[model samples]
Target chain A: EPEVTQTPSHQVTQMGQEVILRCVPISNHLYFYWYRQILGQKVEFLVSFYNNEISEKSEIFDDQFSVERPDGSNFTLKIRSTKLEDSAMYFCASSGGWSYNSPLHFGNGTRLTVT
Target chain B: TQLLEQSPQFLSIQEGENLTVYCNSSSVFSSLQWYRQEPGEGPVLLVTVVTGGEVKKLKRLTFQFGDARKDSSLHITAAQPGDTGLYLCAGASIQGAQKLVFGQGTRLTINP
Candidate 1:
């Protein structure tokens, strides 16, 4: 089955440095999202993108965070300055339709370690 | 606030036994999804329940949505050692982001 794919299975970045996580959603998917899970914690929503604009975002997504669909296939999340709290598994997901019941296909995820 | 809460955070049982995991919330959802994850891997979708009192079964797995649409459950019958994994429940709200809000997760271990 076709699935979302993300780059860099694991990353370790220095505090205050920038990091970019990349994802290539399923080719036909229209909606995209970014979520994070701190170790042993619940998965938290960060942001959602659709039609080339941010459809929704959580408080956890402050000014330091930004998402871009620079091209047709690539969706990227950038953190301006990494922090210890940023150490978590960042998941990228996509869905072909609008219904909330539509299953969102997720990438294996990029594990970020902010030191 | 956490939109979903899963009970019995951890469970261990002998192979061939049955067990159930629950996900509860005060808020109503447009849908509920169940996922399973192994260590260091992203969650893999198991099933999605959309209607109140809906029931779905996949092989030895049974899933149910609560009457009020605010809760859901997953029951596994004759679980085998391969059933061991982290099970997570996520809620998709109708009015909000439509972003899935996940429960803390229930870790299950099935021993032979």
Candidate 2:
């Protein structure tokens, strides 16, 4: 079965550096989302994108964070300036629709570590 | 903000034992979903319950959505060691956008 795939399973960057996390969602899926899980914390929604624009975002997704579908298959999340609190497992997900019943398919995730 | 609270943050039981996990919220949801996550992996959807008071069974696992759509539960009968993992519940709000609000998760250990 097709699945979402994320690159750079582990990422380590300096506190002030910029970093980009990449994911390739399921080919046929339309809605895309980004969620992050701090160690031992509940998974938190970062942003959702559809029709090439951001549909929703959480407070955690502040000025430093941005998402883009640079091409047909690649969706990227970039942090302009990384912070220690930004370290977490970032997951990319997609679903066929935006309806309540549309189950999301998630990627294994990219572990981001800021020092 | 919508929140899902899962009971019994951690559970340990021997193989073949039965167990249940509960997810509760004051706010109603349009749908509720259950997921399982192994170490270092993203959550994988196990089941989705849309209608209120609905019940769905997946093999030895059963899921039920509350009549008010504010709660749900997962019951595992004769759980095996393979069933041990982090179980998470997420809900989709009726008014909010498509983003899901997740519970803190329950860590289960089924010792064989």
List each candidate's DockQ score: 0.62, 0.70
After superposing candidate 2 on the true structure, give the runs of residues whose Cα lies further than 4 Å from its correct spot: B95-97
Question: CAPRI band of model 1?
Answer: medium
In angstroms, the error of model 2 at B38 is 1.2
Best by TM-score: 2
Please give the clash total of every predicted structure, in order: 0, 0
For candidate 1 chain A, the 10 contiguous residues with the lowest summed lDDT are A96-105
lDDT of 2 at B85: 99
Per-residue CA lDDT of model 2 for B1-112, tens digit only, reads 8889998899999999999999999999989999999987889999988899999999999999999999999999999999999999999886434689999999999999
Error (Å) of candidate 2 at residue A53 is 0.5
